[model samples]
Target: DVKVTQSSRYLVKRTGEKVFLECVQDMDHENMFWYRQDPGLGLRLIYFSYDVKMKEKGDIPEGYSVSREKKERFSLILESASTNQTSMYLCASSFPLPGLAASSYNEQFFGPGTRLTVL
Candidate 1:
């Protein structure tokens, strides 16, 4: 089965500190994404990478960045953690559109996210 594993289940950081959250997938998928899930805001995309070393900024990229150096790994970086940035960060991976089987492309699978709390 396809699997996405995040480096941390929870994290605590001081305000203005740098933070990194890592994710790895073993399925050799073609797409990966990072999103912050807030109580009323739902999941807001932060960044996404379609191929190794190639990335695209999502809707809410301010104060955050990403890296995808290896086909199986993706990372999210918070330049300066702030109390307002505290939220559940999720990582997802999926196959290319018109995926493995033309009609088999399904919903994105989510990782047990990293809940980040900035003090």
Candidate 2:
């Protein structure tokens, strides 16, 4: 089975402090995603990468950044953590299907999740 693991299950930080969240996947998937999940807001993408050394900003990348130097690992960076950033952070990776790609965008298998609290 494919597996994704986060560096932390919970985190606490003060406002303005820098924070880093790491994720690693065992599957040799081509896509990795960083998302913040909030109540009512569902899951909003923060960043994603399809290949090593390449990344794409997602819907909410203003307070975040990401890195993908290796196929199995992805990192999320918060230059200055804030209270608003406190939420459930999830990491996912997927392997795309070639034919009928639209229907097979690779279901995201998420990590256990990191609950970050920035006070």
Candidate 3:
């Protein structure tokens, strides 16, 4: 089974402090993603890596960054934590299926999320 693991299940921080969230996937998948879940906006992608050392910024990458140093590990960094950034962070991984429609092939396996609250 494909397994994804995060560094924490819950986190609390003061505004302006640097925060780091780590994720690791047991399956050697080529794509990994980070997302934040909010009440109304739903899940918004933060960053994603398709290969080692290669990353793409998602919709809301202004306050966040990502690092993928190895195949199985992906890290998300909050440069400066803010109370507005409090949300549930999720990590997901999936294999790339060529020639297959995303709806049919790219099913992402998710990790138990980390809920972060900034005070």
Candidate 4:
């Protein structure tokens, strides 16, 4: 079975602090992603890595960055944490299904997220 693990389940930090959210997937998947969950906007992708040390900025990458140093591990970094950045952050990994559309590549296995609160 595929498993994804996050370094934290909940985190609290003051504004301007640097925060690191870690994710590790058991499967040797080709893609890994970080997303933030908000009420109306739903899950907004922050960053993704398709291969080790290769990353792509996602929809809302302004305050975020990602690192994929190893195949099974991906890290999300909030360069300067802010109150508005408080949200449930999710990590997911997936393999590309043959013939599946690129957007639908998110048919993935997700980790229990890190809920961050910045004050």
The RMSD (Cα, Å) of candidate 3 is 1.9
Q: How large is the C-alpha RMSD of every model relative to the true structure?
A: 2.9, 1.9, 1.9, 1.8
Q: Model 1, range 5-61, lDDT digits (tens) per residue?
A: 999999999999999999999999878999999987889999988889989898999
lDDT of 3 by residue, 1-119 (tens): 88999999999999999999999999999899999999999999999888899998889999998999999999999999999999999999999776435622788999999999999
Clash count, one per candidate? 0, 0, 0, 0
lDDT of each: 0.91, 0.91, 0.92, 0.91
Show where candidate 4 strays beyond 4 Å: 97-103
The superposed Cα distance between candidate 3 and the true structure at residue 101, in angstroms, equals 7.7
Q: After superposition, how far is residue 101 of candidate 4 from its true place, in Å?
A: 5.0
Instruction: Spell out the clash pairs found in candidate 1.
Output: none
lDDT of 3 at 11: 97
Which of 1 and 3 is the better model by TM-score?
Answer: 3
lDDT for each residue of candidate 4 in 7-89, tens digit (9 for 90 to 100): 99999999999999999998899889999999999999998888899998889999888889899999999999999999999
Q: What overall lDDT, based on C-alpha atoms, would model 3 receive against the true structure?
A: 0.92
- Candidate 2, residues 39-84: lDDT per residue as tens digits? 9999999998888998989899998988899999999999999899
